[model samples]
Structure formats: structure tokens, C-alpha cells
Target: MNAQYKSCIEAVYRCIEACNVCYHACLKEEHMSNMSKCIELDRECAEICTLALHSMQRSSTFAIQILSLCAEICDACGTECKSHNHQHCQDCAQACFRCAEECRKLIS
Candidate 1:
């Protein structure tokens, strides 16, 4: 992979980890009802990031398209996580935003 792809892959992996962590943490929150959006977004973000990583790894023709979608999902997840006060949420948000940026770089 090229240096750009290498960085994007790293960011995608980190985003996946963060999203997974946030998903579990949100489930454990006392007000589970309030964390529903965060949980949903976290799961979506992780799934998309995983797909993006795989597509990029294989150098698929649709890799750029997948990255575009992944960036959108990451942004949504980041926004949701940022609205929460938990440290896990904050960390996930940061990772999501960074991943989105990296994905955008690959697409553009």
C-alpha cells in the first residue's frame, strides 16, 4: 500500500476499536435509553470502517466509494459521541473525526 493508504488504514483500524469500545460502554451506561443513538452510531461506524479497510486492502474498484460512505458514517458517529459526556464517548468522537479526515484524503 502507498503511504496515504497506510495512514488511512491505521486511522480506520483505530476508529473501529474506538467505536467498539464506545458501543460497549454505552450499553453499560445507567441511562441506556439516552445512549441509544450513540450505541447505534458506534455500531454503524465500526461496521463501515471495517468494510472500508477491507476494500482498501484489496484495492477494490469501489474503495473510494466505500471510503466516502465511511467518512459520512464516522462524522455522524462522532457528532453523536461528542454530545455525550463520558470519556469513552469523547475518545470515540476524536477517533471517528480523525478517521473521517483520513478517509476523505483517500477519496479526494
Candidate 2:
């Protein structure tokens, strides 16, 4: 893979880690019901981010497609997390937004 693509993959991995941490934290909150959607999105985002990262790392022909899906998932996750008032949700939203931007760049 190219250096630029490797950098994007790293960013996605970082976002995946952040999202996973936030997902667990959100699940432990007292008002878990309020964060249900955020938690779900976090899990989905993390999985897609991992897939995209790996695909890019290997320079798969379908890397662009994976990046597109990652972007979409990140957008959804960011929106869902932003709907909550919790700190974890807010952090997750920021991470998701960043990941989405990175993935978007890879797509283009």
C-alpha cells in the first residue's frame, strides 16, 4: 500500500479503538437506554473500521469499496452518538467524524 493509504489505515484503526472503548463505557452508563443507539453504532463502526483498515493495508482491489462502506458507517455512528448528552457518546461522535473524514479521503 502507498504511504498515504497506510496513514489512512492507521487513522481508521485509532478510531476503531476509540469507538470500542466508548462503546463499553456507554454500556456501563446508568442511563443505558438513552445510549442504546450509540452503543450499537459504535460496535458497527468499529467492525467496519477494522475491515477497511485491513483491506487498505493489503492494497485489496476492493479497498475503495470498503472505504466507502466505512465512511457510511462512520457517518451513521457519528450521528447516533451525537444524539446523546453523555461524555462517552460525544467522544465517540468526534472519533467517528474523524474516521469518516479519513475514509472519505481514501475513497477520493
Candidate 3:
């Protein structure tokens, strides 16, 4: 993988960690009912990021395509995360935004 792709892979890993943390954090929030959507999206984003990371690691020919989907999910997850007051959600949003931007470089 090129440096850009490598960097995106790292971002994907970080995003996975962030999403996992954010999901669990959301579950523990006082207003758990308000965070269900965020939790769902967080899990989806994490799964997509994991797939992208694996695809990149294997140097799959479709890695770029996978990253494209990952980027979209990351952006969506970030937007959802930003709706919360929790620090973990904000942090996860930032991570997702970074990962989304990095993933864009591969296809752009």
C-alpha cells in the first residue's frame, strides 16, 4: 500500500476503537433511550471500518471501493456522534471525521 493508503488503514483502526468506545459509552448514558441511534450507527461504522482494514491489509483489488463505503459511513457516524453531549461521542466524531477524510484521499 502507498503512504496514503497506509495512513487510511491506521485511521480505520483508530475509528474502530473510537466507535467501540462510543457505542458502549452511549449505552451507559443516563438517557440511554436518546442514544440508541448513535449506538446503532457506531456499531455499523466499526464493522465497516474493520472490513476496510482487512481489505487493505490483504491488498485486495477492491480495497479502494471498500474505503469509499467506509468513508461514507464514517462521515455519517461522525454526524450522529456530534448530536450528543458526551465527551466520548465528540471524540469519536473527531476520529471518524479524520478517518473519513483520510479514506477520501485514496479515491480522490
- List residue ranges in candidate 3 displaced over 4 A: 1-3
The TM-score of candidate 3 is 0.96
Local accuracy of candidate 2 as per-residue lDDT tens digits, 1-108? 668796687778878987999899998999888877888889999998999888887888998999999999999999988888877778888888888898888778
Worst 10 residues of 1 by lDDT: 1-10
Best by lDDT: 1
Off by over 4 Å in 1: none
Candidate numbers, best lDDT first, in rank order: 1, 3, 2
In the order shown, the candidates' Cα RMSDs to the true structure are 0.8, 1.2, 1.0
* Candidate 1 lDDT score at position 33: 98
Candidate 1 lDDT by residue in tens digits, 18-82? 99999999999999999999999999999999999999888888999999999999999999999
- Compose the digit string of candidate 3's lDDT tens values, residues 12-64: 99999999999999989999999988999999999999999999988889988
- How close to the true structure is residue 108 of candidate 2, measured as C-alpha lDDT? 85
Candidate 3 clashing pairs, residues 3+ apart or interchain:
none
Name the better of 1 and 2 by TM-score. 1
